[model samples]
Target: MKSLTNEVLHYTLFVMILETIEQYYTWALIAILLLNFSQRKIPNSQKKRFATIYLAALLLIFEVGVVTILTRGWPQKLAFLDLAICAALFYFFREKAWPFRFHCVNCNEKLDMNHIIGHDDNLCQKCYYEAHPEEAAKEEEKNKKLEPEQSSETLGLQDIPDTVSEIDWDIWEPREVCVITYLFENDQVLLIDKKRGLGTGLVNAPGGHIELDETAKEAAIREFKEETELDITDPIMAGRLDFQFKDSLSERAYVFFAHTYRGTPKETEEARPFWCPVSEIPYEKMWEDDQYWLPLALEGKKFEGRFIFDDQKMLDKSITVEEEDNE
Candidate 1:
């Protein structure tokens, strides 16, 4: 009776251990499936087929373990049946099941593993560049314009510069980084009449200098709220402005566009808030650069502009609008 009781306890412990392992395996498989499905870079059909095979294999392994535990020994016939089913599944879905491609789809060139897994197009680097000539050109241009390692010395000039070409932007550092946010609602945009500071009395978007350790986006949100008492949401970066002011103030401002906001716009000590129709922006009353780039921004375009400013008057300017990629 004692020997029989010990044997029963041993089987019970084995069953518990098997159940614990099965639970862990099930959870791990679920996590892998979720990760696979969430991946946007991989093809959907490939992800689904891989998930199916993985699930089937996991279920088969669990079934074999369960059968072995229940029968007090490994079920040889059941194990063999599971193997055969896996083999059949692999045979039927070989192309879909295989994740690695040995050749470029475009040029039939031999590809490394990085090309097979890293690229959704299954093309090698050379073939990829050939297929995307514009992207190749952009890459080459970017490589040619590498930033210099040394920073430029302060100009310390007694006279304010009159031309944008006087400053080398590659090594030029800004004294202050600022951010501006334009809130759009329907056909109107929120604008502020500056009451104090640099552009006092000029019409502009709500903006201020970035505080220490704060990101440009965070600073934009804070400045908008402080000036207009409104909480803006989903602020999308639209452009950047590099200002070389004659007053020895070098500023780089990141511009953002927000369409959603909460709270009402109220006048503050720093600015007076108002809603102006998109078609009727008072450009003459605002900074001169606004007339050139604000229109493009309203049309959902990205731009970068460099300006040499003498107080509120712009001396020289260069604006570049980025080409939109519809793809």
Candidate 2:
């Protein structure tokens, strides 16, 4: 009976190989089916050892299949030699496989044997490092002290996305921020020759985007210094304007009134400094909405306005201005 079973098994394997040799990958599928059958026939105590050998054998078969496809044609002698090598490797390493089970002590998570760094504590790599923060920090400091070695590893990876899809598009999206500043000396105001960036060539006050970690008030002060080299210690929040451009970009411009400042205004790459007589301010060269709201602000009124624009043309607009009756 045992001899009959052996003959039947050999005949089945031979027929499968003969049928699948011309088809290339079908032999791998047959091997997997045979492995499943073998696993069922084996006692439960021996399943793990069989599974490890099966996995290694499957990988070897897959690699040989890939090589055969790449070489375009497979010679019978080379194929037989490769099969013999795979069989020998499987036999040599079958008994030497690690026998220890690994699991995370903290989270009760099953872990791969390769991921087991310390068997005494049985902690996963991440949890082990976290539990020893002082050690982690010391290791980090040592890595930082490695100078050339550390620099070479991070030479190009810093601040660069590994793939185009990994880039966060929102960080590069268009943003509009309020840029308005009012300078006061008796009754005169400071206007800037809009030199480079947005609103270039147009007459506007000295203000710009609010930088990170700075309030709009601080931004107004910072922008004032960059554009005019003057510092405003106390800037009154005068009014606000909400503008929407045709391309869906929008901004809220916070108009500030600075009653005091230091340093003389000077020209820089971004703007040319100039004093405009309060009575003779250039309204035509300024933004259209500015003409409507400037008078209210000059009179110490608080206002809120909205403007819809197509390019430089104002498509729609509204304003509400009121004095606080400071009696």
Candidate 3:
């Protein structure tokens, strides 16, 4: 599985490199045409392409222009290559450009990107206004203003779909390293009943973000001590859970879980640690995704997956999957 994953990564990296080269060519060609070098037989389709690439290159250069396009080699070629890349990036992102075509994520159809350019991405821009008329009104107000587009309101507009049949690939996900420990005593497992914040009034495993200057295991131990005021010995490193969620407020969320906790249980305001039979877990009250995968982890399973949601901290639709357990 590791070898297969690496092979896939290598293939993806190679394709990206090839795409970059192609983009450079497209940009240079567009640049030459945009400058209108005399006596060039540029076709109408070519002109349309040039319009896309020229704009793309201009936008890309405006972004990466200052850092000296040159690397260790000759500066001139590097500059030219940079310009070409910008052009390709622009063309590659044509779905987001003007004369927009929004495709429905559920059912492919041209969406009105102009109508709900900000609020709608997963839905076809065309159908969003119809499916969500109220949201459409808000979108209309936004469009009428000719707003200069708020950066924080939307992070990856370039990745959103203007058409009805595409996916918004630019889901922002920054990775973090953390630990998970399943506190245990006899047959019962230790768990935390969260008392505050988003997942309040629910049961959870007793652990927090792995602290700084510490390994995941060390951080888990320290967090247990701080949150529960209990000393644990020999906390084992269980498996991990990779979780994600998205909503109107934020682009996405990622969380990890561990099940190898030790020591006696204690209660705290932040989280009440207790030992409960694994089978009797209140899975329904827990976050929507927990029931689907938590049990697998408790029984010692390693997993990774993407889950969609209507809100950041809450899960709406979850897809729990595992790599082939051939090993």
Q: lDDT: which candidate is best?
A: 1
The candidate, 1 or 2, that scores higher on TM-score is 1
TM-score of 2: 0.46
Instruction: Encode model 2's per-residue lDDT on 30-90: one tens digit a residue.
Output: 6655645544543332444454456546555746654663356444346566667666766
Flag regions of model 2 displaced more than 4 Å: 1-175, 322-327
- Among all windows of 10 consecutive residues in model 2, the one with the lowest summed lDDT is 166-175
Give residue 149's error in model 3 in angstroms.
14
Question: Which tens-of-lDDT digit does each residue in 1-327 have in candidate 1?
Answer: 999999888767766766675567667667656655444354423544464456556556655655565466653345456557767766676666555568988668998745554455678888776444334334433443463232222455564468888667775656666888999999999999999998998999999977755656777889999999999987887888888877677777888899999999999999999999999999999999999998888887889899988788899999999876676
lDDT scores in order: 0.74, 0.65, 0.50
How do the predictions measure up, each by TM-score? Answer: 0.57, 0.46, 0.41
Better of 1 and 3 by TM-score: 1
lDDT of 2: 0.65
Clashes of each: 0, 0, 22
Model 3 over residues 1-327: C-alpha lDDT tens digits? 999999878656654554565457556656645544321332222333334444555655643542433223233335457667766766785554432235666557654533222222446545554443324334433453453253223435344332212333232222333444556656676677888755578776656654334545466667677667666666654333433333222222222333444455567778887767877877776667677766766665654434444333443333444454574
After best superposition, candidate 3 residue 178: deviation in angstroms?
A: 5.0
**Lowest summed lDDT over 10 consecutive residues: which window, candidate 1?**
144-153
RMSD of each: 13.0, 24.1, 20.3
lDDT of 1 at 76: 35
